[model samples]
Target: MKRILTAIVLIAIVVSLVLLGKLWMITLLAGAIAVLAALEYRTISAAMKSPVPMWWTIGAIALFFLAVFLRPQDTITAVVFSTLVLFAWNALATGVDRVLGETASGVLLLVYIAYPLTLLPQIWSLENGTALLLFLFLCVWCGDIAALYVGKNFGKRKLAPTLSPNKTWEGAIASVVAAVGFGMALIALGNWLSTNGSGYTRLHTSAPWWEYVLLAILLNIAAQFGDLLESALKRGAGVKDSGTLLPGHGGVLDRIDALLLAAPVLWFVWVVKEYFSLGSF
Candidate 1:
């Protein structure tokens, strides 16, 4: 219990620094995080006895970070094509060693680890993007806290016993409740900060309240899926935790799993909304 509390406080401090710090700092931190997560994922895949080529695994990590720093304006299609081609080549290079199902596993790793982590920094690159990024983190953090607290005490029925044995239906419901409540609070806060003004405020003066709500809800759903997806991955891998880097939280991958998934979805929504001049509400 003490370990959990200490972990929470440390995480809160780190998150506060990241969200409030300069963009470069955030990008650097996120990049480092991406590398660590990629390593953790590679460990899991190796443990699963995946036939992914060593060179391709290394290349995928490189390409992922390249995409992050370059923030390529028109290279998404190129990246996808390149990744697919490399995947095929890697499979072919393995010759008879590559099993029929191993190719799909390689593709899944790229999609799971590479694609999602690439979006973390992209969130900061959009207009009014800081708010969206912060909101994404908040939704995931709130949902995770809610699930933990609710499950530890009030949990009854299992949510997915095969995947996450600790997860419960009560916890899942609590997570949604916490997400919605956090979203509403953030919306209210954003509105208040925009209107009446406040100390240390970075919000745009003309930003609408509805944008906060919409972004929050979208992030919440994505975050939930992210957690569940990670759970499923761990189950498939026949592991308890992604790694033991963190004392109580498992690994960087375990801690940031939801953020990994949510970041990309949030980034896409922001990009589409900005390009189309569509209101977030």
Candidate 2:
């Protein structure tokens, strides 16, 4: 019940943001998510007795998202230097015994949890960015849901028993099929809406069915990898569910682990369109 209610509220919030279709709103949403996810990471680290400078880590993450909004090109440089600062901060703050481990944790969170999230804002600034962002969320959510249902009912072979015991090959297959189906549905809807009126102009896709299918498969694979990576981290830390902030969602990190990888991969495909001949479509 809690999970269902949480899902409903999240869907409403996401729909509202996407409907607003403002770049600033997307940036604000991404920035908030970065901070909340950082908090969840800090909580997990603290539970594992590997606490770092929470303020520095979270601040650097927030700054990275801000950089995405104000200056996209400088994000890499900013993350590099911020990582260095995080290393130095943790080394000096904590004893030498766990400096390397703790420092690595902070840096990893920046890359794994924080950086990829900022891509949503970047995607929002593109042509048809609103549609693209919505497509991303739809495909990911469909894949997640399909994977869970199919895996629970028909799973026989474990995909990664050590990292995530619940996942299975059947579920992975289901996720890919569902993602592709959802992508095609979005494309069809986008085309119809694109032709009908200019008012609904933000959501459009020119890619052919084959290319979109390939994209669906690619994103599902990336999302699954992100999920496994987070699961491994949690297992290593000897904890489950990064935090209890959400009623049934575990934490912001739990909700976004898949997006962390998929968003950047999807964004990369768009910005590098000439090479892939994506813009022609």
The best candidate by TM-score is 2
Compared with the true structure, all predictions reach lDDT values of 0.70, 0.82
Off by over 4 Å in 2: 47-49, 197-199, 275-281
lDDT of 2 by residue, 134-181 (tens): 778877889999999999999999999999999999999999999999
User: 215-277 in candidate 1: lDDT tens per residue?
Assistant: 666777777778888888777777777878777677888988888778788767766866898
Evaluate model 2: give its TM-score.
Answer: 0.93
Clashing pairs in 1: none
Where does candidate 1 stray beyond 4 Å?
1-17, 51-59, 77-95, 99-103, 197-201, 204-211
